[model samples]
Target: MKKSYSIEEINSYLNGELIGTTTHLIEGPEQLQAAKSHHISFIGSIKYAKYWAASKACAAIVNDNLTMEPIDNKAIIKVKNADLAMAKVLELFNPPAPEFTIDIHPTAVIHDTAIIGKGCKIGANCYVGKDVELGDNVILYPNVCVFDETVIGENTVVWSGTVIRERCIIGSHCIFHTNVSIGADGFGYRPSEDGRGLVKIPQIGNVIIGHYVEIGANSCVDRAKFSSTIIGDGCKIDNLVQIAHNSVMGRFCIMAGHSGLAGSVTLGDGVIIGGSASIKDHTTIHSGATVGAGSGVVGDVEAGKTVLGYPAQDARDMLKQWVAMRQFMKKQ
Candidate 1:
């Protein structure tokens, strides 16, 4: 069922200055162009100022600096930051949570030695290996597998087709999306005695994921050869990402889709990696650094710097090189 909130209620929730009628019922949020009556839209910049007049939304969230003519029957909520305020409004209209019965399904295969905590929901076809420990309210969806001796903390959710390999330690409130493979064997090979073929190195280590971490669909975090591969608290990894053996990611790091970290890579707190970027093995990305999309990072990235392009360098230098190359191409 769709939920509705009055303009006054939304304004109170957002702590925004309300203008126009406070009695309008807002059903949901929509983009400026698509918004209709009873829907709320947001304008964060003057670049979108023109859309405000044309938007049919009964209410609009606007930045404090945004200046626009008001339309009849429409309410305006002026906030210091429209984007952040819109996030709150969207949450008000979020759909209901999924209902999972707090019981182990008959089709689930749980070892006798495994410890299941209170309020956990082990779905059908799920496998809990020997000595595995699941904390309270942990939900393992159908086909999810927890390998031997793995420890999953409270309120964690592992979606269907996800696998948590042996000895991995996952903290509370973490989310592993569908098909995510945690603690998989790392890519480590050595030359054979006769040099005819490669010999695989045994991956004896595990993965440690901290509280409130979220790994998106199909991403993989490889097990270490010696010590644990660590993902710190509040890290958000996008779809199809790869975190190789012995990698250590600091708190609140963000890695976008298709980005990868080679073996032993270290990311300091709050580092941001753009989509399709690749960080070579043993490199360190300092705190607050930003790596642009499609870049190849071969060396350490200095703190707070933004790098871009193949063999990533300072973004400004890369831009200048691109301009120079374009000019040379035109001359030819």
Candidate 2:
């Protein structure tokens, strides 16, 4: 059930300045445009201030720097940053997580040589292969599969229908969502000399995932042909993303939904790959680089640069090209 709070209570919780009436009760938060008289909203910047005049919200959490003034009937809680304050508000209204018992289910199959740790929960029909090591507090949801010789560190949660192939190394506090595939065979093949179709290259390496990584549902990380395919600490990969064989991602990199890195691609720390972006094989994206949505990067990207469009170039250069083409078309 949603809780209702007085304007004074919310202002105190946010440690923000209160304007106008304090007796109004706020049921919950909603977007400014869609908010009702009982719902509270936020105005984070001057650009959004225009919406306030048309909004029906009885109260709003607004940024202190925004030129929003006190109105006759409504309340305003002015904070240092509206977006961050909204996050705190959301946490206040967050729901409880699903509960799982700290015991292995009867249908789970564990090999004799597998080492299960303290407080681990293995769900129904899950398979833990021989010599697999699960550290303390690991949770494997129903129907998950772990192949032989895999080592999953403490407090990692693997959701339903996920699979971890043999010899993979997973670090602590990682969350692999449903249907995530780790250490799958790389797409490597060569034409045979004897008129046969092709020969598959053996994928002998594993995947090494660092701590605090969260891989979304349906994402796949392929095993390397030689060494390990590495995902560094704090990396966040969105749903349906693909990390090809031999790819290396540095700490805290973000890959949006449907983004993909071809084999042998290297991404430095803090690189942001937008949705549907694709990096070519052997491409190196330096630290702090941003690949715009739907971009196709075919070459190396310099540090701190933002690239856009197919065969990605600097964002400013791409914008200039578009402007020039528009002018040329107008003359014709």
Candidate 3:
């Protein structure tokens, strides 16, 4: 449960208007519907001002331009940007990061040929294969198995049960959560006389994850065929995401939860793929293209385009189609 804060106190905190002990409390706007006497909610637009009186929330954070009659029991905090104020509230409730302790677990089996750097901590039941190189202060949690010839950079952290397959090259400050699989074989099969014959082609290449890349829990990145499966610097991949063979993503891209990209797809810098987006193979998506949630991209996407819906039309076309579908349903 979240700690409570009065609306007047929240407004004071957001506007830097008051220096009181109440700024330490944390609450989200959605919680205001169920919040007790001390909970805080936000009213960013005049459109949502109608909900103000109906909300059980203790306080309302509103934009400066909204002119609404004060609720009988609710307090109001006025701010220039309510969205940024939400970020500040989240920061106050953020969890602390784990620190690197200089101790390797005795249950881990490290090859004598491997080079482990100073202050690195290898966890229990872990396997460090031959010729593996770990940089300074790397932390591998319990049950992590890194195959031969893998290289992890300084200050990187691999969580429990993560498997780094053979010949993987990862950069500094990368974080791999539990059960993340790197360098796994890509989907390659040729249909046969017998019900689509399942033939397997070996993934001969490795995965190259650049600096500050974060792969969430249960995410699997397939190895390449001839080159590396490259994730550029500062790319953040959400949980259960699948990145197939030879996929090259440029810097600072965000792949939301459950999104899957087929083999050989190339994404330019800063592309944003929303939740559950599916991009077919061999397609190129230019920089700054925003693929909306549940979009199915079957072809190349131009730069600066926001595509949505199945087959992924332009944003305008997608909206028009939605309007038509709703009208057709009414007629029926």
Candidate 4:
């Protein structure tokens, strides 16, 4: 069932400056063009301001700087940032959390030496290897596998089909989405003595993931050949990302979908990697660096630089080259 809130109620929730009357009810949030008399809309930027006058919404969330002509049937709630205010409003209308009863399912196979923490929910077909320690409120969804000696902190949630390999350390409030594989073998090999084939170099190190980190579905973080592969606090890794062995990412790094880092790559704090970008081995990307989508990074990137293209040069330089190429093609 959809919940309805009055204009005054929403204003109180978002601490917004209420404009016009507050008698109408808001069923939910919608875009300006799609909103109806019972729905609320938002205008985050001036680009969408033109639609405000024609919107049929009962109320609209707008930034404090926005100025629109008053409409009789509509109310305006002004906030510091319309986008942030919209996030709060969306939470209010979000569905209730799913309930999980029977903390440990009967079908779960847990080793006798494993320590299950308080308020944990281990679902059906899940496997907890020997000597594993799961902290309080940890929830493992169905078919999840936690290998031997792995330690997971409080309130961490591992979704179905995910695997945490041996001796990994995952911090509190971390989320591992479906099919994520942590601490897999690194792609390391040695030339064989006979020179016929390559010899597999054993991956002896594990992964260390910090608090509030969320790894998206189907991503893989390889175990290091030595020492740990570390993912820093609050990092958000998108789906299908590959974090190679011995790689260390500083706090709050954002890696978009299909982006990857080769072995021993280092990323400083707040680095942003766009979709499908790849950084070569032993490279360092400094803090606040922005790597554009589909870029191929082969060397170290300086702090606060925005790089683009195959060789990943300065974004402005790459744009100029592209423009020159286009002009030359036109001449032909």
Candidate 5:
């Protein structure tokens, strides 16, 4: 079981009012009908507030202004921001995994020129190529492969089967899950002199990942042709996301699962790309912009605007299209 906290403690941490305490167990509304005596839950959004009446959880962190008809057994921890409270709770409960010993497994093959730092753990069947530099407390899980000249910073963990190519620089405290490949060749093939053949343009660049980034399983980020492909600090990238060559993602940008960015795309700070959103090459999403699910962004997005749909335009346009489609379907 994870760490437990009293409602009082949690509230104090979040600067909220605490009513009770719960053990370290928690789950979403759909997962648990009734919270156990130790269950810690959350109620931030109005959508989730409806479940408060039926919540059997012992304690919850909620908004200060919200005044729901309180449940008999439920203890409400009122805070200024529920999301921030949840984040703190998550940090306390699900802290980073303990670092393993700095032992290279017997089955692993490390090249003579590789530089493995102190307290790093190279797992079984892993391959570290020549000139790769791993920082202190780095963990390469079983069967992971890192190519030559890669530089991984301190306290980073590369999960199983992940492949990082040459010259990629990953910053400290980053987490990369299974099959995450960085600095791979970009889709930079051009037409050859003979139309029948395709010419491969050399991807002679690297990927630069900033500190505290978390990349989910099977995500692939490609290298640029002449410059670096960049993922900025504090970015969280979900599974199967693809960032093409020369793409620049600003700090705190969130990219959901299956999102794809074509070559040269730029996302400003706080930009959020929803699941399955595919941004076209050369597109620029300004700071605070949001892209809706399955958006095909092809043009520039202004700050704070939400875009959706193919040849992605403003969210208003997408809403009109959705209404028209619904009406057309109903008529048919």
Candidate 6:
């Protein structure tokens, strides 16, 4: 059920200064164009503020830096950062997650040698293979599979149809969305001795994921050829992303949807990969580097640099090149 809060209560929750008065109750946050009279919205920029006069939102969280003439009837809560404040408001109205039974379901299959910790909830049709160790309060949804010798830490939740392959080590407070695949064999092939066919190199390594990692649906983390494919703490991988074999992702890295890292690619802390970006094999992206959407990175990126274009280069250089090309085209 949806909950409602008075304008004053919402203001207090945000710790923002209330600019105007409203008796209305805010049930949820909505987009400015789609907001109803009972909903709240945010104005984070001048582009969005233009829609405020046409919006029906009962209250709005406005950026403190933006100057807005007070409307007659609507309530305005001014905050330092409107976007961040709206995230809190959304959490306030967020509903509870779907409840699974507290214990292991009868329909699930568990190997006798598997060690399941206290308060672990294994849903129907799930399979726990030999020597698997699951920590306390781990929740495995239906149809999930854990291969032999895998270890998952406490308070991890894996949604339906996810698979954790052999010997993978997953840390605490991790969330894997539906259809995620962890520790799949790396793409390693070489010409056979006969020189007629490709020979598959054995992928003997496991994946090591640190705490507080969240992998979105359909993403895959491939196992290494020898050591480990590592995902550091607080990494967030979006849907359809791929982390290839031996790739090392540092702490708090964010990979957007469809972004991929080729084999042996290394990323330093706080690297942000935009949607559909592809990093070439053996390339290193240093700390705080940003890869623009649709860019193809074929080489190393230095720290704190933003790269763009197909063969990704510094963002400013790419922009200047585009401007030069445009000017040359006019001479044709």
Candidate 4, residues 1-332: lDDT per residue as tens digits? 87999999999999989988646788899999998899999998888989988888888999999886558978899999999999999998999755566789899999999998999999989999999999999999899999999999999999999999999999999999999999999999999999999999999999999999999999999999999999999999999999999999999999999999999999999999999999999999999999999999999999999999999999999999999999999999
TM-score, cand. 5 vs. native: 0.88
Error of 6 at 178 (Å): 0.9
Kindly list the per-residue Cα lDDT of model 3 for residues 162-228, writing each as its tens digit: 9999999999999999999999998777666587566677779889999999999999999998788
lDDT of 6 by residue, 93-134 (tens): 999877876478899999999999999999999999999999
Candidate 1: C-alpha lDDT: 0.94
lDDT rank order: 6, 4, 1, 2, 5, 3
lDDT of 2 by residue, 223-323 (tens): 99999999999999999999999999999999999999999999999999999999999999999999999999999999999999998999999999989
Please report the TM-score between candidate 3 and the true structure. 0.81
Residue-level lDDT of model 1, residues 226-259, one tens digit each, is 8999999999999999999999999999999999
Number of the predicted model whose TM-score against the real structure is largest: 6
Give candidate 1 regions above 4 Å deviation. 22-24
How far out, in Å, is residue 39 in model 6? 0.5
In candidate 4, which residue pairs get closer than 3 Å at backbone N, Cα or C atoms, i.e. clash? none
For all predicted structures, in order, the TM-scores are 0.96, 0.92, 0.81, 0.94, 0.88, 0.97
lDDT of each: 0.94, 0.94, 0.84, 0.95, 0.86, 0.95
Q: Which ranges in model 2 have alpha carbons more than 4 Å from their true place? A: 1-4, 21-27
- Cand. 4 TM to true fold: 0.94
Task: TM-score winner between 3 and 4, please give it.
Answer: 4
Of models 3 and 6, which has the larger TM-score? 6
lDDT of 4: 0.95
Model 4 poorest ten-residue lDDT run = 96-105
**Where's the lowest-lDDT run of ten residues in candidate 5?**
24-33
